[model samples]
Target: MAAGTPRVFISHLSGVAVFDPNGDQVGRVRDVVVMLRTGSRPPRVLGLVVEVVSRRRIFVPMTRVTSLESGQVITTGVVNLRRFEQRAAETLVLGELLDRRVRLIDIPGEEQGQAPGQGDGEEVTVLDVSMVQLPARRDWEIDKVFVRRGRQGRGGPLRRRGETLTVDWSAVMGFSVVEHEQGAESLLATFEQLRPADLANVLHHLSAKRRAEVAAALDDDRLADVLEELPEDDQVEIFGKLAEERAADVLEAMDPDDAADLLSELPESDKERLLALMQPHDAEPLRRLLSYEERTAGGLMTTDPIVLRPDATVADALARVRKEDLSPALAAQVYVCRPPEETPTGKYLGLVHFQRLLRDPPFTLVGSIVDTDLRPLPPDTPLPAVTSYLATYNMVAAPVVDESGALLGAVTVDDVLDHLLPDDWRESAHREPAQVPVPVPVPVPVPVRGEGANGH
Candidate 1:
């Protein structure tokens, strides 16, 4: 190992594609794990949280990693597919360390070689960390930390105070590899930095009590986003922990389809109770969706989409698509109806593809060029039928209509794929321990439940 052998910053590692010996993409790197060393040794790289094709995260021991370069990580072919569980002693850099405000510890009257904050205890934010393969060491260890003072948020344009001050890992505090304890507020702050999907994955790996605590710590909107990405059982479990009103608010914040799916898993008593707590307008669509069998098109459709009336202009339609945060499949086209442009919209007339919108003048009516040729499916249409309808027309989404010809909702390809996957897909484990190369247990990181820094 050499100092110039190309060190990779931990911040740049997130979402980086990781490949196996055969060059097959396994998954993206979600987080890096390391163990704190005693004496003056730097923390050693232990493993990586790699999310695979099924969206299940697993641990890839550093011993199995061959190379980290060119924006991609290469593995030595030995992968332990067992879903990763954060050991008591392991510290997660990205998930727990990034964006933490810490006080730098320094010796008094040692200004010449003192750390930036000195003994004055100024707060600094850990932006990113660096890992290097030190000479004569088999493992890469945590080295220099990239940080900014007077700013405690995720990375943005590089900023500095008086001058860039380099601090060794020993200069910072709050990381304890012995009793990894964290205040509730510290964990909450760290959780806020993770993506919703990543947070959901992390919650899944946590103890039930820990999950409830973390869930309770999130705001409703954020909780709703994370809940949507979680499995039904986990969703229900977390919901059970929330107050009735809070749970309803979270449900209302969720996409109607996902909310309905979660509700459908609940008993009728619990379902009605929660529905009653939600706003009538928001609950109505979910009620209708729940009535449809889980395998039906109606059940898979999302209530929200870029909708337009026949009289609306292409510009109006385009503007709607632009303003709304819709998935690509849902935004591919705008549905044209008679009057109402909301869920359970007016009698379905047709749709305007994005290309057609671009071709027509902004003021041109969407109805004039609408593709009525694309027939909409009924609420009771089977999942197989919905799949065929989308495939036949090469459309990413298809409208679901009722007997009265009113647009109920629109089903996207993503929802359809969810149904097509094996029912136990979420429950399946993609990782299994390897017999030929067993991972030896080592010392763990005593973190403060998450990333946090305060000069000791």
Candidate 2:
């Protein structure tokens, strides 16, 4: 390690705020870019992949970084806005290396021989990497590895006997070599804190094969959440790879509207097969949704909106609104209905905005505070009308009812926007630039004053 250089664990830097030299917030760190070297040499740290406020990830070379302290990064303020694209030789530390199985050699200088203690040294799984900047240079390289000792089990490592330790980077092996069937347990652990949308973005940038591996590793609910945020093509591809029973379970875990949308993209035979695998009660709402036109309220609305009876108290409504899994739009208000709180609920009475609940006493009945004048949307309402209704009424979600006046679902603003945007909107929003500059191999030169990052 370089004298006076502070070693920082790569995992600790994930999602750390990046700022300009003048202290303006730039973005959050998404991943570290590193180039693996041949033989036993440590991989050189190339740059950071930062997701800015626009959600577009851009590359910021190590040279641009002025300080990494107090859990924040200070940069020289000259960041390129072009989207990041991975080079053939580069690897993402968080995406590719974490949780990977490797052997920790007993001797520091020995790179390839079996150790005198246990065969193949002691097997370990990588948990994180630590890097240090080279002395008098702007370059950085990984120097330490944090690893856990254990063979991987079906659920994960045998936690009771697993031991974790930090070792010199050169003491471990297998990072540079590609494993065709790498398990996603460790990688998923590194990303467990990410929101579904951010996790989906990370998955989007991985190789298709690795993406499938990660998707399969995620539990049903987590996979369902990520699938909803993923691009349609990616969604279809990953969903297609899961075993039929697991696929049906994941679909059932998803929001009814999202599950319906995914099913609509499949062949009739495949779609029906998965649907049949689901419980009859779970498949019923999806069947109803499929009967509606693609761009209509019935198709876009989620059947699981917060529904409450008129007799329910404001306290009851507030408790329902506090559910952690409810989206902001769906949690914005509570639909007041007669009997049967589930969708296809009896008589759509009215809605009580969350704001109204806040203003009333806990004992106040929702029936007394419900706003009936705003009117409910018919299931057949067109997409444009739904969008306009949300905007004009300043509503985050609007109730959708049938001719018989039963509440079927609620259309949230996000669902409306999803339909309004162009089919390729997601692709265009995060598209890579036409060209990318490949990093030069190590023995890196110090940056000259006023020199641009990655040669601009």
Best by lDDT: 2
Go through the candidates in order and give the clash count of each: 8, 0
Tell how far residue 168 is off in model 1, in angstroms. 7.0
For candidate 1, write residues 302-415 as lDDT tens digits: 988778878899889888778645678888999988878787888899888998898999999988999988889988899999989988889999999899998999999999
Candidate number with greatest TM-score: 2
Tens-digit per-residue lDDT, 1-456, candidate 2: 224568899998989999886677888998998889987789889889988777777788887788888999988777676667787777899888887778866434333354533234566778889999888777889999998877542322234347677888878777876777777887887788998988998898888988998998999999999999888999999998999999999989999999999999999999999999999989999999999999999989889989999899999999999999889999999999999988899999899988889999999999998899998999999998998899999989999999999999999999888888888666655554233332212223334422424422
The lDDT of each candidate is: 0.74, 0.83
TM-score of each: 0.68, 0.86
Each prediction's RMSD to truth: 8.5, 5.6
Q: Which stretches of candidate 1 lie over 4 Å from their true place?
A: 3-13, 16-28, 36-43, 47-91, 95-135, 139-222, 427-456
